[model samples]
Target: MRKLNKKLFSILSIVMLLLLAACGGGNTTTESNSNTGEDGVLSAKFGVISYLTGAGAAYGEAITNGLKLAQQDINALGEVNIELVIEDSAGKADQALNAAQKIMSDDSITAIIGPTLSTEFFAVAPEVDLNGIPILGTSTTVDGIPEIGDYVFRNAVPESLAIPAAIEKAVERTGATKVAMIYGNDDALTKGGFEVMERTAKEMGLEITTIETYQEGQSDYNAQLTKIKNTNPDLILASALYNEGAVIMDQARKMGIEIPFVGGNGFNSPQAIEIAGDAANGLIVATPYFGESSDPKIVEFNEKYEKEFGKKPDQFAAQAYDALFIYADALKRAGSSDREAFRESLAETKDLEGILGKFSFDEVGDVIMDVTVLEIKDGKFIEFE
Candidate 1:
């Protein structure tokens, strides 16, 4: 009986050792084979940091919808398999930083998309670039974003481009001789827009009557609006996010300031019209995408997007949609899911056909695309005549 017991114990110990060894081997294989599967198909995981809840929820929702739609289309192609690990930053810089750190901790993550706003991107981009992870900004349009590092890129048209276009159109249509500017001073996006608007207004020979400032989330803009009204400038140039932009326009209308408003990119969202209602009329802004375009790509995207989301795609959604395809194209060109290879391929992207017209990235990773100046007439955006 003693001999039998000793033999049984030895067998059990050997089996346990073998099981432990197998499990260890499996972990190492998973780490090494992160970019591909057993079938030899290239696969990559991307992280998405978005402000899914907060004042900027509309922007985040649109971005999420576009990305999801693109994901479905990309995976259907069967050339590669892509996965997104989405995190909600809630429009806060600290939350955005935390999300970035968490996403970068995974060694297998090939790239990241968004933190929605430029301020959020600013808080997280430097650290992400230092970690060697490529981070793409789908909706951050503020200037100097690409200046952070080679690893950082943005598909959103910068204020330096969009604002000037809108201001020029406003000057041509309204024959404005002077302008009153109001911008959210606390946020990077609005502040950047204001700087561009100021420079462009001066260059176009328009006098700067008054420059008023407000912070984000401030409800009472009576003082600033009163000062702007007193100036009696031909046009009101506003640099603010959708929430603040809507409120400002509403308050201005209520206060009997009936002049047309030439706004920055923050005015591009449909939510602005929804929130401000009739006050949104006569608002002009520049964008790279509009749902009314007759272009084949735009038409097709609109149909499919409307079917999926039960609403017409907005500028933010369209940009995010194109951004995913841009990443997919880079992945295919790289021929591997390696981060360095993907970055090189992405930097070399040029003249890729997308919903936003001929898309390309400049040397600094800013977008090169066409801009259209549109005005809200009867609560709908139509090309400014």
Candidate 2:
């Protein structure tokens, strides 16, 4: 009977907690305490749901740097207070969803910028959408993801824009009547690239060549590369992650397999150079927009970054900067910190000039930006144009 009594009490406590949680508005006051600004204007808070400590940390850190710089500039404008919260996703969808939900429940945030991986972005986007809070993902390229949330959007260029351009550029240049396609079969980003490449290749009347598969974290790409070479393709289209992409490029080059390689955003970073060494020279990839920047504003941004980080800005930093500025732009246009108001404001943005490209979202929530062709030549990135 004593054991039964203990069980009954445990069940009763859980029931009470659930009841309290469901009591709508009961916990809201407590939650709102942290959101009230110094001027009592209830300043809007934004959460960055990201993979701050994972294989994605490099990208995550870039996003954080951009947001921080933008926040400082926003504060300096004497505008309403903006509180920023950053939570680590650890590169998991479930964790991303939970972290985002907790942030939304606080009533402080009017928007969010995160959940790095496309899978995680989609998972949390619906929850954020249901709450009517705008979610801007910095690096999601998976197709059909943005629709997960009505308030969901991304500042980064979508796969539809970048993936096809890479294909067209490679196809046009390589004259790859037959091109072997190797991709990460399970990764949403890589898979999207694969589908787009395959579709475009078929449409262009190029031979389907052969489709090969690889899993993430595979250090040895010799078997796959050898098979691709044996097919005697005119060019190699690789849909891969940064690490794996470098490995493939390096190994392929070592084996005397030389073809003008063109890839998606996976090759936009310096990581390709680091991994492929001198082999990376002359490799081409697609990015959102490559700026022929002469604007004084851009010069200032570059100088500031160089002074602080001791490195020139890469594509990752460019997108991150644009994401934060875009968020702030929405807030300015809305003239309020309210979540719904900002969402409406963001929707009205048309052809706004951004660092990476001119950003305008299409009907399907994809950012309308042209894919930029970038080449690695002489240890520096140059627009192939």
Candidate 3:
């Protein structure tokens, strides 16, 4: 009887040890990279939705380059490893929605970086916001962007600020009394830009000679340019995307309109200079970034970007770079990748000196940064005095 009792006790002890080992294995498996890394540090996944092809590809390329540079710098710090999942929106709203949906379904991406243009943002941001995912718009500047939801934010200064400053600068520089306007009728961004330019022109007591409209992707602006030429206004205001803006500028120059062209946010791209060539010269636009800035940070970023991509960084690149760093700072401060917590930290961002300049978010999630008027001179965009 004593031998049988000892055997039962031995069997019971073996079963308990096996059970404890199973429990320990379970804990170890869960601790090893199940969303959070070892030591309770968060590993985050981020999505970048941009136009890798189609009409908006230039802007997308720049934004991607900036994001990649930021990703490299952030990873070098080794605090958190950010996995960037890229999606090509192809400059289509439907594609943007599809990309955002795919990224969101991963259940790992803590936030989204872009949908490139404001139109894409308008199409996809509301839906993503409904899903409770945070989206940072790197180049979305139109009004009603952040109004999509609490989850929406942007680093680009809106037309409300950029357009007025640009127009005011043009007016002051030329002492122009009459101006004509052209804008894309099919999109919110150009239309919004036109509205702001018109309002600011009126406020400055300048008369609008004519207001013309064009559809995006239209190669021929001769019809509009012919009408604008007839007006013979002191200046011309163009609110258009880069491709169309280039076409318009080229056609205007061919038509012999020598007056200075005051451009909106859509004209704030290096492609404008590339496409318009000599025509792009004297084109003035307002932006938050100047490639030739004397700031060491800007200089370093420019050198690195040029060395990496063989082209200087433009406003799009600068803004996207700033957006990612903003996200990183927020992620670090929140101490966790929880969406809500990180978002709160992002909202509190103030006085962040980035490549662009002093960065801060207003109550509406638009960036409050210095707007510098720039002119295309000798194949480079330089700050206009």
In candidate 1, how many Å is residue 370 off?
A: 0.9
Query: Which is better, 2 or 3, measured by TM-score?
Result: 2
Q: Considering lDDT, where higher is better, how would the candidates rank from best to worst?
A: 1, 3, 2
Return whichever of 2 and 3 wins on lDDT. 3
Kindly list the per-residue Cα lDDT of model 3 for residues 24-119, writing each as its tens digit.
874432222245676655678788999899966988999999999998988788877787999999998999999998788776678999999887
- Name model 2 segments beyond 4 Å from true: 1-43, 79-81, 289-299, 309-312
Whole-model lDDT per candidate: 0.90, 0.77, 0.86
Best by lDDT: 1
Report the alpha-carbon TM-score of model 1 versus the true structure. Answer: 0.86
Provide the TM-score for each candidate, comma-separated.
0.86, 0.85, 0.84
lDDT of 1 at 37: 72
Tell me model 2's lDDT, rounded to 2 decimals: 0.77
Residue 156's lDDT in candidate 3: 79
How would you encode candidate 2's per-residue C-alpha lDDT over 18-99 as one tens digit per residue?
8987987445534543434666543567888878887778777766776777677666775556668898888899999988
Q: Put the candidates in TM-score order, highest first.
A: 1, 2, 3
Model 1: worst 10 consecutive residues (lDDT sum): 25-34
Residue 353 displacement in candidate 3 (angstroms): 1.3
Candidate 3 TM-score versus the reference: 0.84
User: Candidate 3, overall lDDT?
Assistant: 0.86
If both were scored by lDDT, which would come out higher, candidate 1 or candidate 2? Answer: 1
Top TM-score: which candidate number? 1
